[model samples]
Target: MQTTFTPAQLENPHTAHSEQIIRKCVHCGFCTATCPTYVTLGNELDSPRGRIYLIKEMLENDRPADAKTVTHIDRCLSCLACMTTCPSGVNYMHLVDHARAHIARTYRRPFMDRMIRQVLAMTLPYPARFRASLTMARLGRPLAPLFAAIKPLKPFAAMLRLAPSHVPAKAAINDPAVHAAEGPRQKRVALLTGCAQSVLDPKINEATVRLLNRLGVEVVVPKGEGCCGALVHHMGQEDEALGFARRNVDAWMRVADEDGLDAILITASGCGTTIKDYGHMLRLDPAYAEKAAKVSALARDVTEFLAELELPLPVNKTDLLVAYHSACSMQHGQKITRAPKVLLAQAGFTVRDVPEGHLCCGSAGTYNILQPEIAATLRDRKVRNIESTAPQAIATGNIGCMTQIGSATQIPILHTVELLDWAFGGEKPASLAGVEPRVEPALAAAE
Candidate 1:
């Protein structure tokens, strides 16, 4: 794991950080055991250790990224599961991010690849455009089978296949306004009305606001806030990603300065991870550096924030057994393990953990759309593990996980806050419409 960076290379901050990360590797290959691609394909290059060597050599040589390195790197889900498995504490996230940024700058992708990546970058971060694309994708969905026959068009086919049949109406919660607490405002926080999540399922944010208000927490959807940049950041669009970050920092920091923020609450764990890392990502910017650090300091996942709250007893407790799918970002990236599951259990649902919970569901932002074949493999594997536990439904934190897993399995999937909100006397989730909540035996005995 010894690095061979020159003095000139060491001058680059990214190179220096990656070199430190590379040197931390003991070549233990513990990461291979947890890596979804390696577990599925059994390729050494697909594993974190293998990729680390590729990244180290690529960085040390200071050469343009070749197809071999790009292939292995592209296949990576970036789930950060390897980070969790590594006993040496390698920051694979930062290292891989640096590698991706380098690839985007140096490696010229194939025409189709470039076109698709460009399309995703331009479309996904904007809600209106994304919704329009989804509507168009509905028409294209009928051609998915035809597209799948063509090798290059397969990703487009996956996109067509995955587009929701019906998009939800945009909610009032998405507006830049405040929902005050029912009685007294103990805390005021800004909610990230995320790009994709707002477009895909508006109820998740609505539920979060309702639940937060019930807990005496004022929730504000900051006016200028947009995408978390995670969708493009992992794609190696460094400038675009950083631009989104700066805009968000300005928006949220303005809100913080005027209204006061106890926490910048994030419902999407994937977005939460990136939002929480705003400090490290923007450290070099003299103007934004301090503000970004402050923003990251204030950031918290909804579950993380809620776990600290004195939640009311569930007014209408359900006895449904929930298979809690811990997202890779939530567990490894943010190190939030128990909050969601514990919250579900406290809300009177029997929460069950999926087997092989450390593995990725292959929904690492745009990973599923960009690499459909490998993504399908890992997703099927994840679906099998989730099904191994008998549960009435599935509860996950991120919308990406819901989209990926729900497409593969029959079990209804919902964002954790939706269920929590329902349990605390709000409307029941649509997924549980007909499924009756189990009656307790103690109550039956009394009857």
Candidate 2:
């Protein structure tokens, strides 16, 4: 794993980090067993160790990434399951991130690839635009066959089929101005109304707010808080991601100063993991470095916060078989291993672990859309694993996992917060009640 960096490469920030990460690896291939792409493709190039070598070579030589390297790196889900399996503690997340940024800057993607990436980066983070796009997608679903003449249109059709037929009902947006609730405020937190979550399923945030309020925590959804930049960051759009990060940091800081803040709660695991790393991501930014660090320190996943609160358990115990789908970011990125399951079990639900739970369900942000073939394979595998458990319901933290797993399985896939909210005297999710008419296989399984 020794790196031979040229003089020019030594000056590159990314190469330096790659060199540091490379030295930590003892050439152990244990990570290969857990990597989803490697496990499915059975190609060394798709494995973490193989990708690390490619990244090391591309960076050390100070040359533009070639098509082969780009293909292998792009296939990665960034699930960080390798990190969990590696005994050496190699930081694959940072290494893969650096590789992605390098690829975006130096590699020239196909015209169609560029167009799709651009559309996702621009629309996914904006709620209004995303909502409009979903409506259009629904309308276009029927016309999918018309576009079948074009090869690229096939995946678009698949993506459209996966889109929820109807947007979940909107939840009450918490007003930051109103600080006090009827009960004594035990703690105050600014809940991140995520970009995709806001558009795809606003009810997730509603459930989050309801659960927090019930626990006597004053939940504040601050204005001007846009995307957490996770979408762009994963695409190697560092500038755009950092811009969103700075805006969020400033907005939350203002709220913290106005009304004493305890922590920033995020229901989405991907956003939570990235926000928690804002400290390191913005360490070099002169203007907002210190402020970004402060904000990052305050970020916490909803389950993490709830675990610490030790809230009272609900009186009624429902005998339901719950298969807990541990998100890659929650378990491997944040290292939040047991909080969600413990909370569910405490609430009187029988929580069972899905087989191959560490493997990514192929919903790595927009990965399912971009790499449809491999994503489908992984999704099918995950679906099979869940079926083996024969659980009445599937519970997951991140929305991407929920939707991806939902697309593959017939069982009702729900956010952990939604299940907790329902168990605590709230109504069941419509998807679970079989009230919503949809073609999603997961919805049918719920019935």
| Candidate 1: tens digits of C-alpha lDDT, residues 1-447 | 887799999999999999999999999999999999999899999999999999998999999999999999999998999999899999999999999999999999999899999999999999999999999999889899998999888889989988998999877789899899989889999999999999999999999999889888998888999999998999999999999999999999999999689999888999999999999999999999999999999999999999999888999968898999999999999999999999999999999999999988888899998899988888898899989997889999999999999999999999999999999989998878987766678988999
Candidate 2 TM-score versus the reference:
0.93
Please list all clashing residue pairs in model 2, or write none if there are none: 410-445
TM-score of each candidate? 0.98, 0.93
Residue 295's lDDT in candidate 2: 91
lDDT of 1 at 48: 96
Model 1 CA deviation exceeding 4 Å by range: 439-447
lDDT assessment of candidate 2: 0.85
Best by lDDT: 1
Tens digits of per-residue lDDT for model 2, 1-447: 788887776676667777899889888899999999999999999999999999988887778999999999989999999999999989989999988999999999888778888988888888778888888888888876665457666557656766788875544563343434438889999989888888777888888888888888888888778789999999999999999999999889988999778999999999999999898789878888898889988999999998999677685445578889899999999999899999998877788998888999999888988787788888899999988987888888998988888887778888988888877767777767743322457877888
How much is the lDDT of residue 109 in candidate 1? 95
> Worst lDDT window (10 residues) for model 2?
173-182
